[model samples]
Target chain A: MKLLSIKFTNIEEEWKYEKIELFDLTLLVGVSGVGKTQILKSIHTLKEIAGGQSVNGIKWELEFQTLKGNKYLWLGEFETINSANELNPEFFIELGDLKEPKIISEQIFLNDKIIIDRNSEKFQFNGNEMPKLNSTESAIHILKEEHLIKDIYENFNLIILRDHTFKIVDLFDLNQYRIEKLKNQFKTFEEIKKSDLNTFHKLVLIYDVSKSAFEEIKSRFIEVFPQVENIRVAHNVINEHSNFDLETSLIQIKEKNVQKWIPHHKMSSGMFRTLLHTAEMYLWNEGTVILIDEFENGLGLNCIDVLTEDLIYENNKIQFIATSHHPYIINKIPYDYWKIVTRKGGIIKAFDAKDFDLGKSHHDRFMNLINHPFYKQGIS
Target chain B: MNLYFILKGEKTEVLLYPKWINYIIPHYKQVFLEKDVIENNFYIFSGGGIPSIYNHTINAIKNINDNPVFDKLIVCLDGEDIGIEERLQEIKKHIENSKVVLNPKCKIEFVIQNICIETWFLGNRKIVKKVPEGLMLREFIAHYNVNTNDPEELKKI
Candidate 1:
């Protein structure tokens, strides 16, 4: 479920909801505390809201649609699709475009009709105080006209964290337990094969990984990363009780030729971040959206530009969304993918490239903010 | 034609990013010299501001997050293919202005051309020695090795 776009309507210090295009790798750039990270976090929040879940922080109007048609648009009339068949297909949660967009303000709508009218706290059909869900009913089911959206709403996983924890959070913890669940859900016999990163391969293939093939993949990893000198694989070693998915170690290669074993932590922070980026890119090659905060934390200034080029340009397959303090990252990621936000008077304002002067690139805009205080500091 | 031949050593070789180094945005003043020459420069950082032709310069050049002045770029080392490619890169970027006079038997004795680019990058041409020219540096090193460590080695040649 790739995020197609986002819009903010009626938020303070900014205009009403407007469309902002997202690229394969989208960068959120603005002055410090100007709400750049907030834009990414809001995407997380909007996904939750569409699924009809609870969330904190500044509320926003949200609208989304799944690649599949919106069969979950209407609540009461949902069964008609099942009876008549194939009425609604696309499912999306356009935070600002949905029928019951959760804005702090009272009224919400789809196109024109009020989905959530403040005066009418409850939806028009219920005509009572807002129907608080019993931890089951999704707002996605409640607001739209179609009913099949429940599947789309149920599919997403929301990740919310402060700056330091982003790397650990985004990775899917395919521990031991989750693997059992998959087996219980659908049984199949696939021999457990060697090494870490290959677990992703083993489950996908359900076969043995030969010694030669193992080295082949390692060599591929080495082409991009020269630091890795050794590699090995261990299969079928999974925790029986954990909610663990298929987990293997594409871990540090320990070759008999090399006596010293250097743990990944021993590497420089910049190098560490690069490894994490590479691992994530390896997993989420396509639709999975990757969100990172402080992408340039420990990298050298020169490495920042090169790394940015590698991800936003070279590996343009997955959806990459990150917040960065380093200006050079902006120089490489592109001008349009950035969404500039400013915080003023306890309210955050979202601004796109069009809102500002045309000629200035996102990097130049960022440097401009650095020169001007009103745009620099981020919310700690 | 501007050419820059970095008398590269271990200190500079470590800074290369493997493949072709098409261009470098000038951010530090870099120089190249042989390895094993350690001294205290006005440079507060151990390797800071020391002139060297080597790979170890990666960490030192990176120390400039605090102080940056675009003075030098790309010192190289000659280690097998990696070393050779790095040296070739140096020749490619700094083949002009440095006035390189080569005595070799190769169609491509030396070249330093100014290619147009949108960004500010180092413009260097390489005195890419054909097989014969590369062979010459090898033979010259051996020729000088007889008294290579001595200052008077060139007089014997």
Candidate 2:
């Protein structure tokens, strides 16, 4: 299932024509705070809702097309009663509206069939009467409770908004983890192994030389870092207790120096960050969407080029939407991939580089255009 | 569609070329790719000064030849120290030696700011009267009206 497009207003404004059309790999480029991360977070809200988490004040209109040629549309309106009450006391006092977030209107359709449609009080599932749903609960979540609507709910969800399909790797968050881990080896490998493997660990596992499948990855790492002759990953038993109940496996890495294996906590921060980020590229199983913010956080110029080129030309499965403030990151990618987001009169506008005849040597020109004082002004 | 201008100086030359273009052709908006691409479909880039500009422009053309986003090319420089014709010939010779083949249909043009873009600005009587005589073009733009609303109007004087 792939997301075809997403249409939503960020701050309670009615969405008239604002929509982001997504390709297999879409890139969002702009200065800081032009709603790039906000756009990403809005998409993440769908995943949260899918996980039974409620989202408030999200005016969303999303469309998805499956590999099987089925199309699904989810139209939802979330209203925050408290803000309304505070600003307009007369309206909320007369209605006695609750201060929490509630679904004002919700609709989900598969092709032309109305799977679920909810008004303020009652909702219909496949044209059948559903129980009186709380305004706060999503129609998908509420419908999931009914056995009759369970299949429909699951189908709609799996095809359109599977939680696993969406992944956001914010390097800033990873940096915090790296900083804590660097200062103190508080967590053992057993903890990381027991915990759900994040993209970082999933990537690091590729170099777990214990696995025969990772030989290619090991060689690639060697090519990049010649100083490292070989890398070995293992879960060492650092602590043990009676009945093996307290045995802990610490993730350890040994370099080619023929010395004692060191904990991953002791490894260089740059290498750890680099390996974690790039290792995801070697894994063949493509995610539905991968959102990377600050893609150039720890990567060198050469590494950035490799990753950028790979994402732009080679990968076909994962739909990638990345944000970058680095000029090199923005310049390396082709102009057609650029979504020059700018704000004017407090409205964010995204201009597709393909829409403009940005000259034959646009990459060179683009480098200059972005630095121009009026670059923040929406496309003329 | 994309245009490149390899100027032989710093900000003074950078700011002056656009003013000169506006002075010559007022409606032709200076579209830097770093900003927005206007409807006229022209882009201008200044790749530093002197040998850097020469090498950078050549490499940029070659890179474009490999990828080819820019169909039209323009290389501009000041004929301050070097002879304008000699500089153009040297650039042409360098391009001929390289692997790049300029598109036959591409409108490739070369312009030299005679004595430099500063000369044109200092040509204005108002500028000459306002400033001490015999200051460099860079000094003239720098000393007075550095952030003028009408940069091109300096040419009228």
Candidate 3:
């Protein structure tokens, strides 16, 4: 699913973010405390609510396009209740405090036709009244099994949040049982290629399943870190001193003119991050929207250049919404893909780079951007 | 002709010159880096500021001598706290002390912005309104009146 635009407001807190448009590759650029990460968090919160979680006092309107070219406009608000007044008398006596927020109003439109509409007094699906529907969950979650709603619900599953600072242990956690299951499930390379496996599982067997794919990832990794001579994923015995056998598959890399192979845990964070990102880009499923925060945290100069080039030049159908304060990243990305965020008190806004007439002249665009009043003051 | 520029005032001139260049010479494209230069392209390098700009100019001359692709070199700096002739002589003396030879095919030129480049910017009459709203801008206009006089001749307060 691709988010086209969003308008979010927290009524209780009096904080509101103006409607911001999104592109396939949107990069949020601004000074700190401008609510760039809050925008991403709001989207994740909506995803959680779509998965049947209750959150309070947030009014949101999201317009997204599904993989099958179906456009949807979903808007709703969660009702917030006072803890002392709204709780059940018995529960209030025991707990002393309780506050609950539930979905109070929801409207879903598909291609401009109303698929579901619900209010405090009325609940309707396809213009049919149903008074027995639940208010604690989103209509999309309640009707997820319906044929029309299944794709929309599944699209929320494709929104993946990637934090570069946190390592995903599952990608490198290769135990004996998991390895054995993978081996038994796909005995041949063709079967491995035909199976619908996740990125972590596919990556664990990449070298064995397809040599060319492994070589491609290796070459890309080498472009960023030239010291790496070779890389492989193989079974390595962890408990050599123990009587009972304990083994796991670890990603190992050999340096130029060196006999020792460095395992994944022993490698530097920057090197490991570059390798993981390279592999994920190659193996991630199509039609996926990846949200990344602080994109340049652990990246070196060479890694930044290679990754930025891959993001711009690669033909993968993945959409990226990333935030960065690095000047190299800001200058490297085209100005048209930038959304300059600014804030004042409870109001936040995002403006397109084109609105400031950036990139229209052949000047130093980065220098011009830094000197701009909107960027300097962080308000427009 | 491919032109190379070494500018003073690390921040403002580095930003404003290309815009003015593009406005005056719309046909010539500005190259951000020297390696991207081609025919009819201009590239700029900031010298950081005054005394350092003299050495930067000599370094740029050495680079231009080694790469003969550039046909012209323009050194732009403020004529601050000194006469325009003295600033020009100071730059020449630096070049002579460095013992660097200029490329015979490429011509060298200097543009000394009198007082400062910001004064030149203020000379644009269209930017400020006749009846200004801001107090600081109104006071600045009343002190020098750039709208009616040559801003370069305005005295420092």
Candidate 4:
């Protein structure tokens, strides 16, 4: 599903995000504490709610186009209720009463026609009243079996959130038992090719399946780090002291003028991040919405250019909603993709770079943007 | 000698400086690429304006330190409301706080235009007509004839 726009509000937190229009590539540019990351988190929250998780005090209106070319508008609110009211208030208060959040109201529209109309008490699906449904879960999840709602529910799986602050654990560092299980899973090349694996695993699998595809990824990686002469994924005997050797798949890079190949664990964080991003761009399924918070985090100056170029030129079908404070990343990306976020108290708003008449002049757009009152003052 | 410029006005100065530099210093060719700097080459970078220019100056200092090939680092900015001395102090303060020391080999220079660079344009009597067509321009010229008086003393009006 391709997101067109979104409006999110958290009553408890007193935070509200105004309707922010989206594009194929939306770079959320803002000062810190303006709720740029919160916008991404809100989308992820909707995905979680659609997947049957109950979250409190959130009201969201999301407009997206499905893979089948159907435009869907999903709006809903979840209210938190004090559990103490249902039981003995005094007794429950002493035990630290839990607050149960339930769906208060929800409506789904397909091309302006309402598919589901719901309230706290009851709901109507396709103009027909349905039996009593659970208030804690979304109709999209509960009625996932229904033909109209099934695709919408499944589309939530396409929304992927990536936070680069945390280091991605090396696959080789996994416990021996888990590594053995992965080894067993990868025994059949055909199975490995067909199975749904993470980007790193898929990076290794791509090498076994298609050399040309692997070469494409390696060449892209080399563009960022020219020192890397070669990159390969192979089964390395990590532990060979005992009678039975513990083998695990490893991605190793051979650098120029370096005799030994550097394994994944030995690779710098920047190098590994660049390689993983390259693999993700090449390998992720089409129509996926990858929300990357802090796109430049842990990335070196060299990696920023190639990765930004790849993100803009490559992944034509995939959508990227990334946030960044780095000037290099901002300048590298054309102003057409920028969504300058601003905030006043709890209300956050995002304005397109075009709205401010940026990039129209001959001067550097990044310089112009930074000088503008909207960017410097964080309000328009 | 490789010259590096960090200008204030994002549009006018950035567009005009290269032409002025090329005309004034014919031997020093303009290098479009940052890494391709050789002898007798120059590069121009815009720093937006005012406060933003301070950070840009700091960044340029860092760049100059890293690439010692640059023989001169010239910063051209509008004095604006702060005047030349105040603007120089602001830039110096930012550089000092950033702790990005410039290469000792490279000579540093500042060209602070009083009021703005546009005021200097008025100083050229050939460009400023004796009887200006626009009422605002005519009144401005009548009050303070830039051709006669020093344009640097022009106030904010």
Question: Model 4 Cα displacement at B109 (Å)?
Answer: 11
Best model per DockQ: 2
The candidate with the higher TM-score, 1 or 4, is 4
Regions of candidate 2 where Cα sits further than 4 Å from its true position: A12-17, A66-69, A82-98, A145-196, A200-210, A236-263, A268-270, A282-287, A326-336, A362-380, B1-4, B7-17, B23-43, B47-56, B59-157
- What tens digits encode model 1's per-residue C-alpha lDDT throughout A315-354? 6445677877665687566666766656654556555644
Q: Indicate which candidate wins on lDDT.
A: 4
**Model 1: CA > 4 A from native:** A2-24, A56-58, A69-138, A141-147, A158-220, A234-250, A254-257, A261-272, A300-307, A314-317, A354-380, B1-157
Q: What is the TM-score of each candidate against the true structure?
A: 0.47, 0.64, 0.68, 0.68
Interface RMSD of each: 16.0, 5.0, 9.6, 9.9
Q: What docking class should model 4 receive? A: incorrect
lDDT of 3 at A40: 84
lDDT of 3 by residue, A1-380 (tens): 88999999987667889999988889998989888898888888888888888787889999999989999999999996544444345344554344457788999999999988998888898888977777889988999998988999988887878776566455544454467678788766556544556554566687777788889989989888888989988875566677755556778999998899998878888888888789878776667788888889889888899888877768347888889988788789888899999999889999998776543323345545654456767853
Q: Choose 2 or 3, whichever is better by DockQ.
A: 2
lDDT string for model 2 (A240-348, tens) is 4434322222334556765777654565555554454455455534334666777777677756766787788766766677777776777787767777676654466
Task: Write model 1 residue lDDT over B76-99, tens digit each, in one string.
Answer: 333332333454566444434233
- By lDDT, the better pick of 2 and 4 is 4
TM-score of chain A of 3: 0.87
